[model samples]
Target: PSDFSGFTVDGFKDEFEKLVETDSKSIVLDLSKTEFIDSSGIGAIVFLYKRIEKKNHKLMLLNVTGQPYKLMTLLRVDKTIPFVDSI
Candidate 1:
C-alpha cells in the first residue's frame, strides 16, 4: 500500500474488510512505497487492526518510513501494532 492519505484510506478500508472476511491467519500491510499518511488513514488502519484482533488474526506493518513512520511513531501506533522495517 502506497501513500495512505485521505484519498486512499476508503479504498484500503474496503479492501481490508473484504480480506478480513477470508480465512487468512495474518495480515501484513506493506508500506514500503507509502510516503505519507493522514489522520483518516490512521483511523482506517486502527479500524482494521481492531477488526483483525476481534477475528483473532495477527496484523503487522512492514517497511514503514518517511512522514508515515514519524506520524505512526508519534501517535504510538507503532507501540500498539507490530511494525518492522522489512520482512
Candidate 2:
C-alpha cells in the first residue's frame, strides 16, 4: 500500500479486494510515492471503487500526485474518488 513501485495487476487486484472486506467504512490508498501508472493499475483502482461502493463504504486516496495523478485525471477517476495532495 505504499509506493506500488513494482505494481502488477494481479497483486493490486487481490489486495484491493481484501481491503473492501474490512469493517471500516473507508479505505485510503497512499500514492504519494507512486510516480507512474499503467492501464492495469487504473483498472485495479476502479475495481476498488466499485467494490467499496457496493458495500456502502468509501474508498479514499491520499498523497496521489505526479504522473499517476495525471493519468487518473485523464481517466476521470479523480471525479469519482476524493484525493488529497500528499496527505
Candidate 3:
C-alpha cells in the first residue's frame, strides 16, 4: 500500500515504480488521499499498471471517489482499469 498525497507527478511515478519492484502479488493504489490528479498523474498510474502486468502482478484501485473518480470516468480511464469496492 502507498499514499500519494502531496506528491508531484514524477514523485508518485517513482514511488509506484519502486513499489512494483517488490515481488508482491498485488498492488493496491490508495487514491483516496490524493486530492488532485492531472494528465501526468493518470499516465503515471497507467504506466505502473502496464509494468506490473508485464511482471504478472495485479493492480487494484481503491477509494476512487469524488472528483478523481469522475475525472477518470470522463477520461475513459476507468474502463481501462478496474476499481475495487472499498479503499
Candidate 4:
C-alpha cells in the first residue's frame, strides 16, 4: 500500500502472519510506492523483522524513499532492518 500507516498496519500484520506460515527463507517488503508511514507502521515492520530474525530468516525493505525513508532513518530503523535498492 502507498500509505503504510495505522490504517494499513492491520493488513500488514495479517500478511505477516501468512508469511510466518510459509517456508520462504527470505522476506522482502517492497516499499517503493509507500510514501507515508507512521509509528504504527514502523512498529509493525520492526515486529516483522524480529519475527523473521527469530526464524533465522531475513526481512529486507526495498526501495524505501521519500518521507518513509526519512522517518525510518530518523528512528534508526534502517540500521535494524536491511534496506535494498533491488532484489
Cα lDDT, all candidates: 0.86, 0.78, 0.77, 0.91
Instruction: Please provide, for model 3 over 1-87, each residue's C-alpha lDDT reduced to its tens digit, 9 standing for 90 to 100.
Output: 233333567565667768889899888887877666767778888888899999998888888877678788899887868888684
Best by lDDT: 4
lDDT per residue as tens, model 1, 1-87: 567888878776668878679788888889889988999988988888899899999889998889998999999999888897766
Specify the poorest-scoring 10-residue window by lDDT in model 2.
Answer: 1-10
**Mind giving the per-residue lDDT tens digits that candidate 4 earns over 21-72?**
7789999999999999999999998988888888898899999999999999
What is the alpha-carbon lDDT of model 1 when measured against the actual structure? 0.86
Q: Which segments of candidate 2 are over 4 A away from where they belong?
A: 1-7
Better of 2 and 3 by lDDT: 2
A best-first ranking of the candidates according to their TM-score comes to 4, 1, 2, 3
Residues 1-87, candidate 2: write the lDDT tens digits. 333433556666667768988898878888876777877777778878898899999988887788888888988898999897644
- Candidate 1 similarity to native, TM-score: 0.91
Clashes of 4: 0
Per-candidate RMSD vs. true structure?
1.2, 2.5, 3.2, 0.8
TM-scores, one per candidate: 0.91, 0.84, 0.81, 0.95
Better of 1 and 2 by lDDT: 1
